[model samples]
Target: MNQPSTPASWRMWLASGQPRTLGIIAQTISTVISLMCALLFLAIAFGWYMDPLLALHLFLGAILCLAFIHRTGNPLGTKNMTFAGALLALLSIACCGYLVFEQGRLSERLPVLDPLTDLDLVVSVVLLILVLEATRRCIGMTLVVLVSVFLMYGIWGDQIDGPFYHRALSLEEMADHLVFTTEGLFGPALDVAALLVFVFVIFGALFDRFGGGNFFHDIAQSLVGNQHGAPAKVSVISSALYGSVSGSPTADVVTTGSFTIPLMVRDGFSKVRASAIEAAASTGGSLLPPVMGSAAFLMSDFTGIAYSEIIIAAVFPAVFYFFCVYMSVNNHAMRHNLGASNKNQLPRFWHVLRKDWAYLVPLITIIWAVLALNRPAFAAALACLGMLPVFLTKSQYRQGFFKNLIKGLAKGVERVILVGVACAAAGLVVGTLSMTDLTGKISSAMFALASGSYVLTIITAVAVIVILGMGMPVPAVYALSAVLAAPALIALGTDVLSAHLFIVYFCALSAITPPVAVAAFAAASISGSNPMVIAVTACRIGLIAFIIPLIFLIRPELLLQGSPTDIIATITSTLIGCWALSGVTEGYLLGHLSKASRWLLAILTALIFIANSWISLAIGLCTLIFIYARRHQAQR
Candidate 1:
């Protein structure tokens, strides 16, 4: 008979046949590196001053080392370092070390003015190659390929004979701009990743580890778990709350969907519908406030906007996105007669609050720090510190407090690897664009293609952003979209915040968009449904997300950019419009909607979304009210 499995045996299995000593050594090094990285960022957040580029190099080096040891494609797996990975890890450290060591000299040197020494060139080239490889390993080839294409353009675009051609940089110029200057690898993207995104990720990881995840789930269950389609509603509420902190749709799906999807399926939700609902809800989390996904922080860096304003602007749209999902799930549950969960099967609200109420303080602390204090990094750090007391509240957590803290640090660092690499890689793309003026050319071409029509230009820009978002992480997608598409929208007279947020929405939606929907595919493994089917269903459920951006773009009132009365009116119309759209998507509102009724609702949704005056709002509102009234009377 086979022996029962233990954690030690599981570790051995995950090591993939590596020698026991080697595996142990790799794990030790990984843990040490994780702690060092976390502490490094924490120190900075608490006002430790270091040269920004030096700090970024140290952070990137640590991430690359972690990426090599942790193995690609398996985030939660044990360290399985091989000879090749070990060699690459050493090279990463050496290259990054040289930069950190020479930061003082490099900082004083001007790009294209001071020539790079032979050693400088070698380090630059080696570091670039290591970043590319680490990016491929951590994020996959989509970003690697995109960065490679930009690097090539930086080298050879001058030889091309089209609208896209630009002056090329020589080998030395390329190396100097990309490596020696802050314009390239150590640019805003990586800077934000190293500074803001890392601390927030740490806070999120610790918050979840120290009972926040359970609190959110229990609260969601208490609110809706005994209602019709309780599982699906629970998924939405829990995911939104968790995703707001996690800032990763795919991670959120894996975390919440593991419990929610199974419950949904057991409760008679179709596997595809269950997976799709979870995917849609999780994807919206990155769009939620306070500690949104890494990309939102990058948006703040790129646009020079305050992080607080970005979250505030995002509130209405994010809430509406979840509202639409809730409505769709409710309609589905009602339409199919899905049974309500037994009250005894769910956690009691008061009991959960009494037990886990402390978990909420960190979240409240972070939000207050960001919104009131206007210091996002400081807020996140304080939240991380605040989680310490919460861990002590539980006897189980207290017994292993230090162990769990180390694990949370390691996990948070592991999570930051993807964003760090993506940001570093995106730096290459942004560097190339800045050097080559590709952003201008693309924006001009898009304008010309749209015949100077603002609406057409916006349409063309959205298509470009969505296409670029496919098979890419949100940070990379937003980076590319901001450079490639946001310029066109801005040039077409869109507000800077709205243009970037527009890019953010679609980049996020790409995770649930068909063909390459990463979040949907993540749900597929749990729900045992076809990934494509889940993607399609997710799009239907998240239909309002796709429309919300366009609505806000046309009428900024929805984004809280108008007078109080205007904001109120726009929100009211949008709520009604979203209700109509939800009904159209799920084929139920007051009751099952007929084909004609769906079509009518669809038209009303369009009118409401495009409403530019009170008359338009009045018409749509009255029609929606009449339809609901008529349906209620018919049912009677």
Candidate 2:
């Protein structure tokens, strides 16, 4: 009898190494571990009996192991494991395993009251090192260095003479606080990551695996592929849809930009402008509602706000963000006289809907479950489960269903390791800040520096968030900002929700900010343009994003915090302001604008956005009308 054939995935796994059996075993073990961890979180989401600490320990352990196995080196370049990586992976297992077995006993021991045993101390120290190392490997040195600074501060803070100084912490005290207690590596940040964020990541991974991405792209193309500037508009719509679920702007650019950027260039846009447009559009995805990025989940956890409430409040700002992008693209298309896409090449809207409409059910399930049922984690879990029937309905998905399920689950776990490790690292920062009372000191320093001016405080916070966000991921940036700058904003009389949302806005924007614009860089790779040029163009295209956060900060009604009339009025004025700003930025309204007209429009837009009163609104209207008449007379 002929030997049975190995599965394609198994063959693919074994193709990476010299020892076939070893590769098979390693792949099997990793897949099993990932699945088991995923199932554990799923069970916990369904109210399974497990200690929260144990769950976090399991999550951190498996993620660290996977991180070491999949990535090597400090800057995280290599995808294959080396001997050193294997050793680190083993160490991660042993260290985390100790806590996993002893979690119950450790949980009952009062932190700082009960002295740790030698082995306990050893495990704590090793686990802390492993977390930092894994963070360095998976995320990069930026976060690792930030976490290290916090650790060093926790150790020698008492030696400092300034107001920032705090009481000294011993090695054992630091280890116990960060490793043994829930306040450190196992805090709300990790808790949220292990449960809420992980489930959503799985949902997104499986959704993409099962053709939701194609469905979204097709739908967008069908809707706008025949319009002028069709490619850029498709990038905005598709990236917004995908980014809502994928939640990573860089990943969104890589996924959708591969198609949209080339199309934009083919249509008429410059390579740099095309890349920048995609980057800006993808960056806005995290701010979109229904299903937002992982940082939004962190926001819900950090602010004690419901996920549904956050998404609901995000509606106006998110809409206005896309509106600005769309208006900018429309003007550019008009200016360049870009023609509509070939009608024959566009997908039929009804045909796409009729065929792939089932893909939307999972997304709708998430929105309904979160809003109607108020169970965000369960909502994500249900969406993942809901994908099965939808997958079964399609022959391509139904074939090799079991293998695809395994592959999707494993890929989901792998994809989340960066986020998981980042959250754990963020926990270290939060733990240190809490232990040292550094957050209060920083907030006080900021307050004094701003001299009790809320606008100045906001500006300072924005600068800090964007700078911190430069090389860091959104989760880390938001976590750091939430603890540091947000407290300052709240102290200066900003609303709690607004302050946190303000931090989130800047965090997302940093992906396109210059010097280290991750999203723009990713787009440049596809567009074959200079990354900095793309970053500059993206900043111009996304200028409205920077302003929208400030608008909501001034008018809380923009976040749905006021009466119906107030909400409506704020949204209307902001939309008009965004339109005028887009005109100023693009130098095109009814026609190409002269420098004088652009300046006049810019001033009126500033007046409208800054004053937020009837007089400003009337003046803005008159200015717009005057500009329109002048342009019309010129056209005649």
Candidate 3:
């Protein structure tokens, strides 16, 4: 027979020859990374300083991402690739450990090792290549290509000979700057990942593996299960709650949509629409507080703001986004008579809460520590985590408590490694900007390109963020965009909070953005609908949520920064804006909206968004009265 094609031939040879070995090796490395993380987390939770912890995280990241290359592989895999992977993993552990051991010497402000150790130089070059390869394997070729372009720019910036050009730098100088300093791979991005984001991610994993999902279900069902479109509404609320913890929108969909989507279809919704609602609601979860996952922690690092302050700032937009989804589902219910269960059949909210109310104590503790005590992110999460053992006292949780606890801890470790690796990869981009001072160049380019139109600049910023976010996870996308795109907004007078959340909002939306909508794709797998169809529907269903950041930009008060009166006013108008916006998008109000009316409602909503607070409030109130009156009258 003719030789198989390259992909098939590779698979055949790999399957027969090296499959089990690579698989075993990858699993073994992943487990070790998990174990290392356990040690590191315990070390920090017990009150150690963060300097050494950073080194341990980076070390595990290097080893884990390299081994992921073996697990996830490339076309170039060979018997040699496996050997090379093992060698790289071992050397990486040694190299990153060396950096950690010598962090005092490798300080960002300290003098470079002028000549550089031969071993350091070799490790830097080899480790950089391996990191690039690992980034390719775990993230995508796009990031690898983007980082390569930055590396090239940092090295050869002098040749450009323009306002953007920099002085000549030798290869050794570049390597020293990129490797031995915090200017590159072990910078703020990784620092935040190690210090805060990793801990929260572990806490989230632990919460989920313990019983967070069931609590969300009980709570959501109590609130909306008797309403019209109960299934969709439940998805909205539950996804928002659970999504806050599980920042991966696609994973959230698979977890909750497995329950919500089927019920929606059985309750008179189409598969596409059901999937769209779940995907959109799930997408907003990462924007929710507690663990806005990586973006929120990084925001704290980037803004030099306290994590508690960031949490407070984040609450209104997150609530407003979910409110928009809840309204859309409520509107659809009115239009289709969708959500009614017999009151008798539904679980009583109080009864459910009383039964598993213990499950909520951890989250409540976390929120209280953040909002009330102003504890740091890690401390807040750790406080809640410590209370989890309290659940073991209950008979319902006693069995398998230790078993699930260990598994949850392991899952957290695995997740942090992924985040750690991504952060290291992000640091490459950050380092290039700092080393070459390219941020100023790029910001100048954007300013010139926008020609001073603030709206166009903000739009361009969002587009850049969305495009960058298309294939990468939100944190990686946010990290890159914070360096690349967020400056455009800041240059145009957007505040740091607005600029950061502005990027984060779009990155979360990317889960339902077309062409590469990962959450919609997961929903499609469940609903058996076309992913593109689901994505488009999701954009329409959640379209109002898309404008929320803009609303915040229009009125900073919406971010909870201004006076209580201003904050309350902005929130009231925005909530009303959401009602009109969602009504327009769903083509429903109290009852089905005429097409022309939807257009009118949409235009009026946009105007409400840009108007002065009083005017916006007036318009918002009028729009709400109009929709609510029509629906209420029709019901009568």
Candidate 4:
């Protein structure tokens, strides 16, 4: 009998390096042949006789990768489970691949008709449902249930309630749209995933091998780790590092929270405070640039914006967000009388730098390449890989080069699995919406409810984003918002970039909001705090998230939408706005604020920030000064 499969965590590799595991990983010889056969037949059936073998090969490659992943316990599978999963995964690949290849090949010859063939129709529907289920198993039951509801609406539209109700499409039509066309399921979402998202995943993995994590941690430590609230600040910086690479808030929290949360607690931070700080900071990572929480690429494909522009647009908001979190931690430190680092106790900055200086070069090179070249994700991946040799030359880190390399690659691939599936599953959502014109209905209804009030429209849109974000990750959150709320933003006369980024910011903030806060959940697991308490604190600390979106919505120039002077003005004003807002939220400037002063400053700062006029900025500054003077006098 075959040995049992292991879990996908690091511990599993240590427990068993069994030979069978490798074969299972390779999906054995028989499984590969079966998958290849499936693809060959699929290609022939699709009338791709001219390039039958080539199409079959691509399909086979997809299937083999799918089978290897399934067999590796990467998904919820075992040895026996692998055999069946490999077969099913192979079949699904063949079906989807043939559909894509055939569609391309037939475009010039003949238009592929609805429910093109009986075989195609049945396989597409079956495979779609399977993909959804696979996504549910890997991510959560929430998205599956959500998509199921959508499918139900399409099938039973006449019976549904509310303005959302409409005549339903037949099952055949639904399947045909979802599987065969770009409108339904086999759409840009999946295309972006297959092409762009995977490369970034590899890029992120390569960064890790180049000691990107250590570089981030050391830099954060050197800069902020000696402050009064050093641990909290470190959490912010480290989360940014992980966020830029991982692109998931929950993943960021898990990666950095274990170290930072314990450090914060040991250094006299409350469990709730420490966990909240980490949670809020980690969630902000998705909003950070270069990697930007993984939505920039998707946003580009969906909105026709440049990827570099998304990165540029996100830079200030992300900075403002982390600044707010840092301020919260600073205020907490002051309130609790947390002491600053003892010079003798703190690690020597120069020593830390000298020790790991080489590790830092790769990250710098990556950022330079991205901004300077404006190249694709693959270019970034190549740059990162090219820099790895320099990092490996360090004597201390050299011993584990190969080990880290493999681990990073494996982790990166594993990270992409659920995300890849989520995108595919979201294709179902996008596919259904496009096919049924459900987005138009939702948008029109949202508009009717707002009745031309921009504020009300924004409120409703944000509420939807927050609600959707609770059960989904950032990509899915943005996907749902892009489908539903984006049109609402466009209708309000907002720039397309600002509108989508606004939706994305709100969706990203949800990871720190109450109820189903994934980041807070991860932090709380380590800090032993009540998840809700941590989540509420996280929301408070991440207040800039709420404000920045409003800023971009009001002043689209903030998203790098204007001339050079306009861009400079927007950035300057936004930075000042952030400072004032941070001061207000902390209830401190020169000293602690009185209750009245805090409220006044908060109101004035928001007014000025949103007003975006010089006069408003001047008045806001005066109020800030007044608060500071009053606090200074009281302290004296």
Model 3 has an lDDT value of 0.76
lDDT of 1 by residue, 1-636 (tens): 988978886544333221122367888898899999999899999889987878988998898777776654333433355677889889999899998888888888888998999999999999999888887667666677789998999899999999888876799999888887888898888888899999999988888877788889999999998889999999999999999999999999999999999999999999999999999999999889876677788899889998899999999999999999999999999999998899887889999988887787787788888889988899999989888669778888899999989999988998888788888898999898889989899889999999999989988987888888776778878888899998889887899999999999999999999788989989998977899999999999999998999988988988899898888888888888877778888888888887887887788788888877475579677867867786988778
Pitting candidate 2 against candidate 3, the one with the higher TM-score is 2
- 250-280 per-residue lDDT for model 2 (tens digits): 8899999999999899999999999999999
Report per-prediction Cα RMSD to one decimal: 5.1, 6.4, 3.7, 6.8
Across 64-146, the per-residue lDDT of candidate 4 in tens digits comes to 34533443433223544456455666666666566666666534432235335677677777677667646655556677777
Reference-based TM-score of each model: 0.95, 0.94, 0.90, 0.85
Instruction: Please identify which of the two predictions, 1 or 2, would achieve the higher lDDT against the true structure.
Output: 1
What does the lDDT read for residue 181 in candidate 2?
A: 77
Worst 10 residues of 2 by lDDT: 13-22
Q: Among all windows of ten consecutive residues in candidate 4, which has the lowest summed lDDT?
A: 11-20
Clashes of 4: 3
User: What are the per-residue Cα lDDT tens digits for candidate 3 across 156-180?
Assistant: 8899977889988777787887776
Q: What clash count goes with each model?
A: 0, 0, 4, 3
List candidate 3 segments past 4 Å from native: 1-29, 50-70, 74-88, 101-113, 339-345, 387-390, 394-396, 628-636
Model 2, runs deviating above 4 Å? 1-25, 74-79
Decide which is better by lDDT, 3 or 4.
3
- Give the whole-model CA lDDT for all candidates, comma-separated: 0.86, 0.85, 0.76, 0.71
Ranking by lDDT: 1, 2, 3, 4
Q: Who is ahead in lDDT, 2 or 4?
A: 2
Clashing pairs in 3: 227-339, 228-339, 229-338, 229-339
Candidate 1 segments exceeding 4 Å error: 1-22, 73-79
